[model samples]
Target: MCSIWRTLQRGTLRDIALVCLAVGVIGLSYGAVAVAGGLPLWVPVLLGLLVAAASSEFLFVGVIAAGGSPIAAVLAGLLVNARHLPFGLALPDVLGHGRRRILGTHLMNDETVVFALAQPDLPRKRAAYWLCGLGILACWPVGALLGGLAGTVIEDTDALGLDAMFPAVILALVLPALRDGETRSAALAGSALALATAPFLPVGLPVLLGLSGLVLAVGRKRETEVIR
Candidate 1:
């Protein structure tokens, strides 16, 4: 406890807690939305445990709400979350090596990455991980509980602009890192490909496009080095 407290102190535990609070409030709305849309409370809770990405959870929830096939829902969810693979791969170096590294990498998700990157300075890698993991665990379960109870109370969250916050927050966390020509192009290309294929494909194409972009990025980097 003493060591953890020191870690949080160096990492500005107050700020991390505030961010987690904000996410918690937002998560309540998510729960309500999911419940209102027809998902059982357990679904979101279980999803929170496994699928750490909000985008993927939203995709899955949307598919189920729309009465889409289960397979389609699964595919769409995977597509939206495929970006995590690269994100996970890239984070280990920053986190260091070994068992803790594995835990941190596995727990790193959209919000956690954003929260960590947002902090210009931090005490230790574990500090960021605790802030993020504890934050998610705190917020999601509470939101799900509230959602179960008050799901019927809220009428139209879309009109209140709460619905837009999720995507905006996720994008805010990601877009800042794309401040380069190659990354920007890759994102655009991947998005375009995904949109183009969405009509004919069964909703898994965005993941495929993202994978393609990763491959392209590697090749492009190699080519640049070769040219140099």
Candidate 2:
């Protein structure tokens, strides 16, 4: 355990700071966009409470703005963020045992995961926990507040192209992780399915298809590894 903790602390604090900056910028941009999109002031504030993925937060806001029911909105948010479940399951081997570890496991998110996974030589658990914990406690909420405030003052959100930023950020963040053939194929297939269903189904279907795609990617990855 001592060795594990030491290993965790070895990550370059500088790198962690860089990851935090990325998250803060993207999160703040989202809050500003949400407000510019006509979301209530409380919307961005409350979103910070969830402390989940900013991408899912953007999707959740879209559903609410579209007049979707609250139940459907919640379902959509959960579906889009479902990938976190496995992320948590895979975390413990890195995090070790205790209350702080447990809490950190729950807070592990896309940005944190990216930062930690990319640092293959560092203590995986420690780097992951610190990076995510700091981001959750500071970066996201602060960004939201700033963006929300900025949104209130802007008269022409439409002209700013704020709406496109959410999808753009999501793509920029997630696309880099699709390095393998199976993961890329799954994303493409899921996106195709989502597009095909977009005209018929409303809010929730795209998320479901995305989840389906992720599951396929995971299963296919396991199968290929087994063959090797």
Candidate 3:
């Protein structure tokens, strides 16, 4: 308990709890959506447990629902999940050793990685990582199950006023990192590029283009160097 409290001193526990809750709600909505779209109750629940990736699962569902190719949906999801490679690399210490490490990597997600990175030290990072990761792992699928069962009655989740919370949780997690000028510029440029291209491109491509914003931030570094 002392260790847990000490870890929370970096102001992680509350945010972790909120993030878990937000993802849980989103998962519930996903379940509701899947069932309403004619998917069996088991499908979303299974995906939630095995896939454990909200973005990828949603894209897959959207594609499949639209009668698009499953191969394309899977490929898109794989592309989205590729971002996890760096996430795994950046979080070696937090992952622990052996069996724990396997579970840790399995539990990894944007929320877990972000919360871990937000911490000031190793112990706190580990605490944040596990807390957020485990919490989401538990919540997301359960929410999906409940949502699937309820989906027959409530097909749409937008009415629940939850559309904003997911993005808000993400923004809250990332806002601190944006304090760095280069990161801030990169984020802005990425968001701008993503938004600008969204209409012209496909659903996931804009997000990939947004990563190119890091290149734009390089320009700022050059300007700063010349000023010095």
Candidate 4:
């Protein structure tokens, strides 16, 4: 507990709080959508607590709302979230080992990963990762609970512009990653594949297909090797 307090005082807490505020707002939007789509209030609340992956939760809720089968929804959610496999691979050091790794994996998300990677050193990275992760874990579920209850009263959350927040937040996150040439190339290729396939494919499949962007990364690596 004392260590936690010290961690909070270390200054990354402010950034974590700010990001979690956005996450909470997004969580509220997600809860409202889930209830409005005919899910029980507890569904979104539970998802916020357990699933905790905003994109996957949104995709799952959407599939269910569209009358997709539960099995199909689950598969879609898994497909959409498959990128986490690479994330886990890339951050093995930050994730640690044994019992702590279980909690670390659960807390892993785009914001936490980005915040941790942006830090200058290993200690700061670990601190930012855990702080952002734990903070989001708290804020997300609370926001979902409140939103689920309020969802019954509110009819059109889109009018409040919450609908735009998710993509805007995602774009903001990806923009920084694009600073790297290889990453930028991969993103462009992935986006093109996603867009081209979106009309004919199911929601999550486009994202899965976008994984082909790794080909660009491979090609970039080979080119760099040749140049060297």
Best by lDDT: 3
Give me the runs in candidate 2 sitting further than 4 Å from their true place.
Answer: 1-11, 95-98, 121-124, 152-228
Residues 69-171 of candidate 3 have per-residue lDDT tens digits of 8899899788767768767878899998999898888898888888888888898889888888888999999999998887756555678778877777778
Alpha-carbon RMSD to native, per candidate: 4.2, 5.4, 2.5, 3.1
Predicted candidate 1 versus true structure: per-residue lDDT over 1-228, tens digit per residue: 356566555435665676576566666666777888888888877776666556667788888899998898888788766667776665555554787676566567666766666554555545665567767766766765676568766566567687676667657666776887888877777777777777876554555665576567778889999999
Ranking by TM-score: 3, 4, 1, 2
Better of 2 and 4 by lDDT: 4
Q: For each candidate, what is the lDDT?
A: 0.68, 0.66, 0.83, 0.82
Candidate 3: list runs displaced more than 4 Å. Answer: 1-6
For residues 62-180, could you state the per-residue lDDT of candidate 4 as single tens digits? Answer: 99999999998888888777768877887888887899999999999888888777766777678778888988999998888888888855566678787776577557656776999
For candidate 1, report its TM-score: 0.68
Ranking by lDDT: 3, 4, 1, 2
| Backbone clashes under 3 angstroms, per model | 0, 0, 0, 0
- The deviation in Å at residue 187 for candidate 4 is 3.0
Write down the TM-score of every candidate: 0.68, 0.63, 0.86, 0.81
Q: What is the C-alpha lDDT profile of model 2 across 1-228, one tens digit per residue?
A: 445345554444555565666666666767887787688877776777564567678787777778887787778777767667766665555555788776666567765665555555547646555655665658777778787887755444457665565455456556666776777899887888888886777554565566577777788889989999
Model 3 steric clash total? 0
Q: What is the lDDT for 192 in model 1?
A: 73
Q: Over all chains combined, what TM-score does candidate 3 have?
A: 0.86
